[model samples]
Target: MVIRLAIVFVLTFVSCQEENDIAAKNILGIGRMQAVAVSGRLICNGRPATNVKLKLYENEILFDRLMEESRTDSNGQFRVSGSKREISRIDPKLNIYHKCNYNGLCYKKFTIKIPKDYINNGREADRTYDIGTLNLANQYPGQSTDCIN
Candidate 1:
């Protein structure tokens, strides 16, 4: 009788713990996100030709999903971030670019979403997140190129 009672108590405690965990994690589903946009001369007709207004796209939807937007600096640089909670789910775009070479001239948008399981797995995920940079095709050079610097 004592053994059965103890088992029941243990099970009850575990179930309650699981319930608590679920409750705690539910509040942060979106995940925190941030991004930087940049534009530069890429051997355009030998000399740099000022690219016109180019709209950068992330997640391939439209010009609305971006959490933040910035005009390119004098050197053509921009960064956007969509803040969301960091949990077991997929996070928002880290960086967004509008007008790869120029702005408002048939703008092309790009989004970068990374596989962030670190919140749940911890250290193990760091290796992947650090080993390289996450590259999404929509960027200026597309997926064919990779940069982690």
Candidate 2:
């Protein structure tokens, strides 16, 4: 009877009760998933943009599932969650999105290369990675190409 009670206690502690209102406001589950905080500059017209909407992408698709977005402050700097460190440390993935309207308007999405083992200095957490600066130009409108340098 003691052993049965102990096992039940352990199970209760480790389970994620999402459907059951599991810690309703809890940001992340106890399972193996990544956590990220992202910020950077979205250069509009070669300068820090104001109220520029940002988007994140994954698997060549962009939406609610694989993306998080934020606006750049007056400094033209912003951040977003990039990846999870503890669960998938080696596979760091970051895709920054931008949209500009000029000469018929153009929108583009670019991928930033981040290797595993890269640590974010700001977070001081080993599981986080940085996708540096993302600059967008309206030279070629609406060409959703993966920008890499």
lDDT on C-alpha atoms for all candidate structures:
0.35, 0.48
Q: Tell how far residue 82 is off in model 1, in angstroms.
A: 3.4
Per-residue lDDT of candidate 2, residues 1-149 (tens digit) = 99999999877754634344224323464324444454556676677766655554323222223435666788677765543223223233445445544332443555554453553433233553444444566433334644431
Q: Stretches of candidate 2 above 4 Å error?
A: 1-31, 57-64, 82-92, 100-106, 118-134, 138-149
The positional error of residue 75 in candidate 2, measured at the CA in angstroms, is: 2.3
Worst 10 residues of 2 by lDDT: 57-66
Cα lDDT tens digits, model 1, 53-141, are 22323342222233344443443333322332233343434343333334343434443444444223221222223212222222443
For candidate 2, what is the lDDT?
Answer: 0.48
lDDT of 2 at 13: 52
Report backbone clashes per prediction.
Answer: 27, 16
Worst 10 residues of 1 by lDDT: 128-137
- TM-score of decoy 2: 0.47
**Cα error of candidate 2 at position 51, Å:** 3.0
